[model samples]
Target: MARFFAAIGLLNLVIFSTSFLAAEEEVMTNSWHVIFKRDVDHQTAHDVANRNGFLMIMPMLGSKREYHFMHPQVKSNRKKRSIRHTKNLKLDPLIATAVQQAGYKRSKRGFKPLKSLLDEEKPIESINAFPPKKGSNEEDPLFDKEWYIKNTGQAGGVPGLDLNAEAAWAKGYTGKNITTAIMDDGVDYMHPDLFDNFNAEASFDFSSNDNFPYPRYTDDWFNSHGTRCAGEIAAKRNNGICGVGVAYNSKIAGLRMLDQPYMTDLIEASSMSHRPDLIDIYSASWGPTDDGKTVDGPRNATMRAIVKGVNEGRNGLGSIYVWASGDGGPSDDCNCDGYAASMWTISINSATNDGRTASYDESCSSTLASTFSNGKPGYKDAGVATTDLYGKCTTKHSGTSAAAPEAAGVFALALEANRKLTWRDVQHLTVLTSKRNHLEDPTAHHQWTMNGAGLEFNHLFGYGVLDAGDMVDLAKDWKTVPERFHCTAGTVKGVYKFDSKNALKLQIDTDGCRGKKNQVNYLEHVQSFITLNSTRRGDVTIYLTSPMNTTSLILSRRPNDDDNKDGFNKWPFMTTHSWAENPRGKWILFVTFSSESEEFQSGNLFEWTLMLHGTQKSPYTSQTSPLIHNTKSKLALVKRQHERAAEFQF
Candidate 1:
């Protein structure tokens, strides 16, 4: 049965209604005054930026489209906001309190304001002040227009979501009919490589209500950030300039959710754009900060809206929201932000390459970590190559913000590979199809440090940094069950085989939470997470017991998304198996064999099995996965080893 909302079409979701929101339209006009696009009963929020208080900084939202950036005052000092007795600085009480709670010390609070309040050091630096063209001194070709794809990973900076990754994923798609939206800063509307895939029709600016989202004279000019981010995710390859994007065939749309004071405004606009026929995913690389036990600012309003949209879903439009964690990492303690912790959207953390481990990483204390870089360690070894802003990208940009766009670009490719993949499916596949699991395997060069968050969905790397080949392959066989998964790289090994009539079934079904102390999946399984845990304490594990020696399992429960843990994916727990935290005894396992196994290979017998971790209960499907797919996608798989392996083979 299909239940639909009548008053507001399919997406008639009730966003947080403020007592004054209905009247906001009449009061909020522009140019001089501002409006409260949403309501604030008695909790959570601020009215508006002080008049002339609006400052244009880097889009908290990130991008990788071929950006034409300004010197963007790399002078920013990301810190915990605080209220202190100082002649030079001042802080908003609520935001400062939030920062303190988020864990940042009061003194650690401060960022170069976009504009000068009183002649203090500001964030914007004149273009002429740009560091002398010190490019080419390094090895990355992304900085050299003269170089072709050579500058990519192999050249030390892997071009994100570019041609090679796309070829395998873009089999039948051109991204024509599909439009992917990014919730970031502004786009480089003038970039040649991005214009083709750019969808102005599907784009909007939440940062500014004036309809114009391009960069301005404000401290955050050089609209290139959004463009660069977009380019990395979906730039038109084969255009013959420098390089390509992940979803070269998919249409790219932008929603300027950053660079402004009112995230509520951005959220409202994002909600209104929830049309079934218009967009696909909304990618954002911005999030709340991570403090050991403090919150420096209010939760993101746009993020709040994203949660609503996730719960309410789009106009059956199949759109998902993607966000980035913060970058105060290598600090040994991860302090990612709010959106990444929120279950409403999929959060992305950053990884470095070219030889160094994933940089831009947060302390292990954060969630949703991963890797994606213009150039890092291993580039010299992996032979991977990429295109980049070509500006002075010498410094490593490690933050959740950097990580968000990486995931978003990969997601764009997923959409290009299969336009039908809904928000839920996208998140599911990403977690299941990630590549970090192999690092834990005996055969791989397991540099445990590269594995952020420690294990699976730890605060560091969310579901392990991405793997392009695996993601593309996942998209190819996503809708179908997988059989005989070869040592395929980058994705979970859920290779399904089809019967003559095309009936479908999975090869793995392991319970999600086997044991528990609280909401967290612990230092291990956290890497695979896209959603936060029910509880925030103790521990939870989702592993299959190798046959021969198996017994009782553990099921853990904790607090909901309300406020248990810091930096957790805020949504409910979801699993590949339809089984819930408690899979009833109705579960079983079977094993069949075949002669051959390949991508298009046929005639392979399969194995089906189930193992309960905790207790038994009806409707065991993961609370999270179902919400995204509107259904359950879990099963069981066992190899000749009789090893109770997972479906999301990494």
Candidate 2:
């Protein structure tokens, strides 16, 4: 009789727990956010919501006047009904706006795990062991395989084709006193390799609406992305777990915004601006679908949050944002990805262990630098070694996803060396210090070009692979760059037509806002805001030539972009190819249609405007040989030699 009573008690507890969870899920699913007007008092808003059978949850994060509310009478699965209720809420005079809370999938930039490629099922003894080399201090078993950190060519990789992390480590700059936030699915804070460095105070879960950003587990371990990325930045050193991080002493914060049914602008904004005062760097590896056609970017709220973060975060030093240049390969152009192309973010591309462009790398002028990812097949232990989900470790992290965090780790080291570096200062350091290692474009579409300012740049590799040692050395003595200014050089307003056979060329001439407060002499980022309509948008290619005769292919042909109705509406096609160049003469633009479909297509250029962003005075005046005067002639000679060599290859 006693045993029977105990079983009944257990049954009742299970029933109660199930009922409570169901209620909580119902509340979460039926939630809607309503932005109240400034004039509406909280008491009045509460009374109105109560009269309408709504219960207040709380205020939305990163929003001033937005409040979350739920209607008990509304069914959780009735999305259309929930949306209708929000529409009705918008009709109230006290409410400024309303939106139903929902979830959407944010694509992880890393390649999905393949059973054939992954060695997760293999026993520890079955994997080939790489003994640590001489003078190595890392005791972690996987350190020998981390070629990107200190490449010794353990896996058929080229020696010294690495980020030179050891050099920075030698200088005792291991990202101390800095925090980097990984904005992804969620982080395994409990993982032994990362637990020591995880900053719980700066972490949050917008998806689950909780303070704990722990990843929700699954059978297939699909949510290991954030954990891997975090491990790349802050996994503990000499932990006897996994390989050491590039910034092993830096703090890691997990902002869990992805891994939901659908993504909302509020979630994105909250993640981007979360604890900006505490989180110095925001590392993001996810973006719009890389299906070779999608053109998407941050929404209005997210855009505002990013702008606010960079302008006001980190005690006005500006929050640093590192982004992954998309992995859409040769068919897609990253110029369409606004997040990567934005002047506010540092877009990073990927190179392989062999120092070649990754097979899936997308070429664009906006990519700021390159980092090592994974090598080709048949190379032993070529993938990145980092911590995985559930206290495990992985040797298969690959993609621009892996590359971005490494760049973030490098930036963290720089920050530790100099805490006063602003967002723009980091970009300047990257352009000035990044090296032209052995990275090459296998497609041969983009060759190394020497700008008028003598800076070498490539569409595939940007300025070049990051050199942590050089970056830190420069950061230690780096002065804040001159205050940035924007100048509108010229605008050409007219409709010009072009067909497949004949290309359309337009020119704009101006003094670059000379004799004004916003005068720009040295160039930084150049933007060509264009509006056009094409019969087949995918066939259109746009190129811009700076006054210095340096040409930038701002927009390449996207064969998969078949949309003909939308075209481009004042799309800001940007390029860094003209960095440090003068913008005071005639600028030329060429728009042509190239297609193999045998379909004759035409396009109309509705308007063209040239915008220049730089400083009135030279930013390099503090350094020796300002404007790279000593290298100009040498660079020009190399350019001519390269052109001659290309002539024979073609």
Candidate 3:
């Protein structure tokens, strides 16, 4: 029998006695959440909860087994109920017992009360200075200021250290029929430069629970983050006022979920899933706190949404998600962020105008590629020129925040080039086409090494900067990659300690090939799960080496991070530096406490696991056939190229 919370009699409200509280008595509300066995229905779960002493129970949105329930009276000694309150009252175990007696096993469970996951995320602000105008007469007035799109020695930017968007644009691939959703605070859809391609039908304001995804505060400096991001991807081409976007003809929608007073996991999930059918690319510039000490990512609902989007969106072509690597500077690692590390998202970092890593870019092995953005540390830099709040234009748009949307715009051009590309196909093309050593001076000292497949990779710079022309060129002829294969190594369990003078090492061996035909000769991502205890996490440095001797400095010591709390509790660090490596040999993980400060003590490595995700050596038929669609697309593309060539003829 299914148990529906709505069927419960009027969902009775029980008020407890307030006199039992102190003079400064706090309102203690008690509730419990549980995920019953999959076989159990809503009615049965309701009965189970009612029999277990829950006074009022309600199901969580989108989940039938999962529910939220309230007790008749306060049992704990706190002003408000918390995870501790639930534990102290033994609510989790009690609910577990009740569900078990009801003949259903709990496949998923949670004890902590659901609260706002939004805490700390600062937008990367563009520097105050603007670049000089060097665009030709036919170009947008501010086009020369967009060093990230057209780096032609303007504003001290190294020539050619850009996305090569102009080259793609010159070929008439200006992001037609592509729609990217800016999953940020909000976007100024009416801005003159953005209005032409604004996707109002796909827009939604989850922050305000409205249909229009517009900034709440039109004049506020912070409200412009989304607009700036949108401008980077789809600002109108040759608009005369502001600079052009990477995909100037592409459409963009704003899914307003961030910048609210409180953002729960459900809101974020909704934002991520909103109009997945319509939004081809989901561009997000925000994530967990980047304070160098915090480690977090999307919660349960949001994770489900991410998986769903990639699996079901775009009629199974898969939605392309572009995420900013982070702005936590040298101290932070992008691996700590779940969204950036996920295979579903293309994590992007930032390079400065001078062809160097941006000062605020967080280094990590998970970063796939990067693009030019703003200034570097100790150097005056010119930021990206883009649309701002209140129908204004600004020359200051910087950070990985700006880098993500720029990548999104470039991707739109790729989608236009060939509409048959899947999410994985896009990543494969990026890795194959991204440039290396384009930076005038890479700030990170790690030298680039050839992975097992002979692809150059650097921990700080990712595969390298995204080459718009190259990606589009490759994407046009790109066949979908072979079937994806995932393999996990044995888990390492035990407490171990080490320091700079003595590094602790562990090795796990693997057979690169899984089945007879599905050998993993090339790599897409390498994930390392580490559960350890440390007195000072900032003191720890980790290195992961592939069988090919390609080393990734996974963790770098942060001088400012002195938090003594538990460090890296079952955190998964990912790396793309091992691309194309044969996974057949032993992989080594090196953990060392490098800080000499006495404040840092030795740590314990309780357990670790290594998971590899990559493509098979042999091609296989995919569940979805893109070839039929590509056939038509190829014809259209050839026609366009020929027409473009004729137009260019003198």
Best by TM-score: 2
Per-residue lDDT of 229-295 in model 2, one digit per residue for the tens? 9999998777567788999999999999888765666678778888988999999998877877776
Q: Identify the superior model by lDDT, candidate 1 or candidate 3.
A: 3
State each model's CA lDDT, in order.
0.36, 0.79, 0.68
Find the 10 residues in a row with the least total lDDT in model 2. 17-26
Q: Record all residue pairs in model 3 with backbone atoms less than 3 Å apart, i.e. clashing.
A: 2-43, 3-42, 3-43, 3-44, 355-439, 523-580
Query: What is the full ranking by TM-score, best candidate first?
Result: 2, 3, 1
- Assess the local accuracy of residue 624 in candidate 2 as a C-alpha lDDT between 0 and 100: 35
Q: In candidate 2, which residue ranges exceed 4 Å CA deviation? A: 1-33, 39-63, 67-83, 91-93, 99-105, 113-138, 623-650
Q: Against the true structure, what is each candidate's TM-score?
A: 0.50, 0.86, 0.76
Best by lDDT: 2
What would the per-residue lDDT of candidate 1 be over residues 504-590, giving only the tens digit for each residue? 332233333334222111111111211222122212222222212211111121112123343232211222212112221122222
Of 1 and 2, the candidate ranking higher by TM-score: 2
Model 1 residue 16 CA deviation in Å: 11
